[model samples]
Target: MAPKEKDDKPIKINKWEGAAVKNALDDAVKEVLTKKFNYVENFALMDGRLVICGIAVGVAMFALVWDYLYPFPQSRPILIFSVTTYFIMMGILTLYTTYKEKGIFAVCIQKDSSKKENVWEASSYLPKYDDKYNLILALIDGKTRQRRETSIKKSVANYIDVNGSVVNELVEAEVTKMHNSLLSERKEK
Candidate 1:
């Protein structure tokens, strides 16, 4: 359970629960680690596709060995084997050409009624968080944007809009690609 606030004073988070808090923190850390693992897995998948393609070609190219081994001897079996391996390898290697990618995204908006200015910041490209997700940052005006995180001054409110499911693959992509995210804050009027 979430720690309850004391009646008369500000809740002292550390004074109450220790193990519970630690467990919560540990869970959160594990969640993030899982995300990172997903990212690496996607990277590895992309890498593996390339490697498979290479191996397929390597197998087919070795078919030429049949000619060398057949000096004056009729190695019909070798020739047929090499040709079959080459065709099968080429067919399998060609499949890598068709592949797709995806990622997750979050949006944050900040606003203050008193001011006319707003900020659009993404979860990615924040300089401190360029990689690990896909971030698209844009400086927007008073007008609305198609899809973006808007922050107005003073409210200090928080809003998160997460898009897409957890992709346990492309963990190491630029944060903006692996996930789409935005953060913005606004002040109270």
Candidate 2:
């Protein structure tokens, strides 16, 4: 992916820095690793097991073919064991790659619905503290709107520690206004 155009929006820090706040931020970051984002977490344990089983069967068939060609008494068993072990390892690796591909597949599906313009280039925004922080604030706002029972903003407000509630209130209002505008536009269409 190419670098994204720089955002002109000012980077704003609302909270005080502290060990507790850092830990909370770290935890919140980890939340992105779930199926909601990473997608691999949704894989069933059986998928891995099935891959192992398939490998075993394929290795057995290969061993049989090798034995038929060589017809050696001493080398057959050793060859079979080695082939089985090697194939098992390779099979496990292949299965893991498949599992990872599934996650990417999920991401691709969600990518289409994410944003029409694709202005938020995650690659460019991820490394900068300011961009990442603002992105998190936006995510919290959107998530909080989607699930009213769980206030993502309230949960992390202490960590971000914007001086007063005013900053957060402003963010909420903006999110709501944008959401309402989108709804009204859709209704008009």
Question: Which one is best on lDDT?
Answer: 2
Best by TM-score: 1
Per-residue accuracy of model 2 over 20-99 as CA lDDT, tens digit each: 34333433333333322431322344466567667777777777778778787955785869676867677676776576
Measured against the true structure, the TM-scores of the candidates, in listed sequence, are: 0.30, 0.23
Q: Which stretches of candidate 2 lie over 4 Å from their true place?
A: 1-126, 131-167
Worst 10 residues of 1 by lDDT: 152-161
Candidate 2 TM-score versus the reference: 0.23
Clashes in each model (backbone N, CA, C under 3 Å)? Answer: 35, 3
**lDDT of the candidates, in the order given:** 0.36, 0.39
Model 1 lDDT per residue over 48-128, tens place: 557776776666566566566665257666667766877776666455434321111222233536464443322221122
Task: After the best TM-score superposition of candidate 2, give how far the Cα of residue 8 lies from its true spot, in angstroms.
Answer: 33
Error of 1 at 98 (Å): 2.0
